[model samples]
Target: MYVVVLIVVVVVVVVVVVVVVVVVVVVVIVVHVVAAAVVVVVVVVVGVVVVVVVVVVVVVVVVVVVVVVVVVVLVVVVVVSAAAVVVLVVLVVVVVVVVVVVVVVVVLVVVVVVAAAAVSSPCDHASSSSSSSSSSSSSSSSSSFSSSSTSSSSFFLSFSFFFFFSSSLISPPFSSSSYQSVLIVVVVVVVVVVVVVVVVVVVVIVVVVVEVVVVVVVVVVAVVVLVVASVIVASVIVAAVVVVVVAVVVVVVVVVVVVVVVVVIVVLVVVVAVVVVVLVNFEAFNANYKIYALAF
Candidate 1:
């Protein structure tokens, strides 16, 4: 009976040992499978996430590049168009100013010539009348040399008084002669022409200077505006890129946190299951040990 009991106990112990080993092996295998599964899931998720991030980054970069190119092209076109417009405006202004100045010069010249001619006409008529009157007086004096010595003397006195009075009334320079009057008129006309020409040249120079200044100012403003616009565009592009990078980083961090949480949860559940299995198996082994002791 003792031998039979011992043999039976030995057999029971062997079977229990075998069961515990099998359970342990099964748990280990399950843990390995779970770990492998978790690893595969993590790898797959990470690979997909990496691909998505790369694609997004590439797309954003491409978009930014395209936008920058388009903006640059637009800026160039605008600058060129503005420069062309400024040039055209300057040309038009120059042409208009020149035409106006020429017209004014022509009109002034015509007016001066007319005025000079009108002033010369009265002087010419007066000189001609004086000459004719002197010729008549000379003829009369010769004819009446013997018949009118008193009359000639009286006529000469009256003529001298009349000439003196006329000379007092008219300025000496203008009263000189018709030739002198014409020469004075010519001088006046020439002086006037010279003044007009000088004025016109001065006006043209001033206008040209003003035009140059305006063109310079416009160019400077355009350059400043372009520079400012470029700076703003560059800043915007940089900000957009930074935002995209930050967003990608945030997404990656969130994904990593979620993966870590899932892995931690899986590990905790596996540990709990292993602990429950171990507890149940130990209880069964204790019950079998008590039974073996009672049999002994």
Candidate 2:
């Protein structure tokens, strides 16, 4: 009975732990799903920001061109100087490119920060272990993974910003030939940044899916083991109960048989004693009668 009770207690504990792990896993899955939604929202916001930045750049360019052209025309009215017009146009284009580059960088930084935050958020690592030490180890590993991913993302963002800023500063001056070149470079940088962001998002998503899959698989295996253990425990308990009952029955039968034999032996001894007494008494009476007859 004691062994059965202990087994039952153990089964209950294991069941409770399994339930807790299941709840944790469900929570983790929900968190990951929310992260995914957050990523989508970030992407959409980034796109809108990019559009706004482009519009701002275009408006700035048109305004600068119109202002410079007007100044040049007024100068033509005063004293015609084609060289001054050319210089003014080149200066205006350079200023516009600089503004556009700054706006793009700021937008890209926003995107990077948002993406990094999503990746770095603590993921619930609900690992079931037969021991506390193993559980702690799994938790540490998960934390380390999150930290590494976060650091790598930060490094990538910094490197991208440095590259864009440095290349812009070192590139040729803004002129008719270099204008298209600079614009191409800026577009390329933007595209690369967007692609990198997308890739990181994909990697984070895959990690979440894999983690959830592993949790599910572990839960299934634990359940199967628990069921098997319970079955074995039940069988052992039943066998123990049967053996105990059989032993008690055998002991009772032996005790009754011993009591019956003792009773029978006492009865036989009493009957023998009584019969001998009656025979003795009758013999004595016959002896007396014979004597009396002789006297008569």
lDDT of each: 0.41, 0.39
- What TM-score would every model get versus the actual structure? 0.29, 0.22
Native RMSD of candidate 2 (Å):
52.4
Model 2, 165-211: lDDT tens digits are: 44333321122333343334334434433333233233333433454
Give the range where candidate 1 is weakest over 10 consecutive residues by summed lDDT: 1-10
Q: Give candidate 1's whole-model lDDT.
A: 0.41
Best by TM-score: 1
